[model samples]
Target: MNKSYDLIAVSPHPDDAEIGCGGTLALLSEMGYRIAIVDLTNGEPTPFNDNPQVRIDESLKAANILGIERVTLDLPNRELLDNIEARMKLAKVFRKMRPKIVIGMQGMTPKASPDHYQSQLIFDASVFYSRLSKWEHLFDGMKPWRIHHIFYYYTARELFTQAQPMQFTINISKHFETKKKALLAYESQFRAHPSYNPPIIEWIEGMGRYFGSLVGCAYAEIFYGSTILELNLFKQILG
Candidate 1:
């Protein structure tokens, strides 16, 4: 049997998870939840870097910093499509890992790579595909296992996107530094990248601060849920 995880985040590239929900992942790990990140692509051939191994090593280092496991799919970067093959590949991982919660990338980024939106579609289809019975052949003989929850983390690239009324913000105030370190691990993309004018790190930190303010925390991340969330009591809202 494949190793099980309590949660899994589907990322379009190596740094996508770190950018979207790294602090939350770090906090969850500290809470003792078994979590992993599945990167759809290696995030290669950028303007500043051409060596794929560098990106791979960086991703592993970031995963280590976050106290989580990392799995990089062989899917093509910059050319990711929401097709059957892509869906099957991810569905296989969902079947094997058997995550109770699957967090995926949300929103479209017209200024960034189109892979983000495609990855979202793939994540959606793969979630459904993972629960289909008698499709063992398609998933390498793995048995059907339904994921109980699904959520979305923003890429921080959508300019005018607004959070839904049911959307929730996770307080990552304690683990905010850990999230910064995890992002710094990808030096090739962040600190060393020349084309980023206003500096990417600052932009990310600004988003964190903005979200944190919403929840009255030092730092937080926003997530969208597929279903309505239930509160046990009125006091739960106080947090």
Candidate 2:
């Protein structure tokens, strides 16, 4: 069993983590890579679950669907700030997960909530914090995690299109539906919500198909990276 991971998806909110790399996570999981998804918040300001407890419950249910390690920072919606306390909490998780690759939102917004930017900041901080020697407490016996690569996943496609140097894209057509199913686990955010006037499923599929077309597929997930991408000498290609 290949328990070691090559990549990890980081998100500030419940759905953000899954949406950005759910298909890739699933595909990689099938291929035996250990994948971890971090959910920084409980998806607060949520219109559906009037009670705070219910939203937390829903988030956990959704995490179970993804099938890997997960964490909830429980940060308030639209009020996240970059601070030492918050960074340390995230850093600890990074030390434990110890992934080789990291990806998260670029904090792009049109009519976006503060959560969008906060989420991105968390990813950036975690990526760097994990490598710092100053943070000796995050890991057992001060073992630092040095990630090899980092990428920014576009936050809101309806508003922002990052012209970042494109490294590669995951053709999600084959398992895009699997990703959607995992998303559907967040029933509270969609069906359970009072103002879910527009079901999330429709938007997810629309974006999936839209992006998938970019790489000659029925559905695909896109990612932009700073470092160059290299196909392993023995890499098994995926459709």
Best by TM-score: 1
Candidate 2, residue 172: lDDT: 75
lDDT of 2 at 237: 48
Number of clashes recorded per candidate? 0, 2
Taking the tens digit of each residue's C-alpha lDDT, what string does model 2 give over 86-204? 67677767777777888887756657566677667777777788888855754555467788889876544455655677546788776777788777777767666536546567777
Count of clashes in candidate 2: 2
User: Using Cα atoms with residue i matched to residue i, what is each candidate's TM-score against the true structure?
Assistant: 0.95, 0.85
Q: Mark the 10 consecutive residues where model 2 has the least summed lDDT.
A: 230-239
User: What TM-score would you give candidate 2 relative to the actual structure?
Assistant: 0.85
After TM-score superposition, what is the CA distance of residue 105 in candidate 1 from its true location, in Å? 0.4
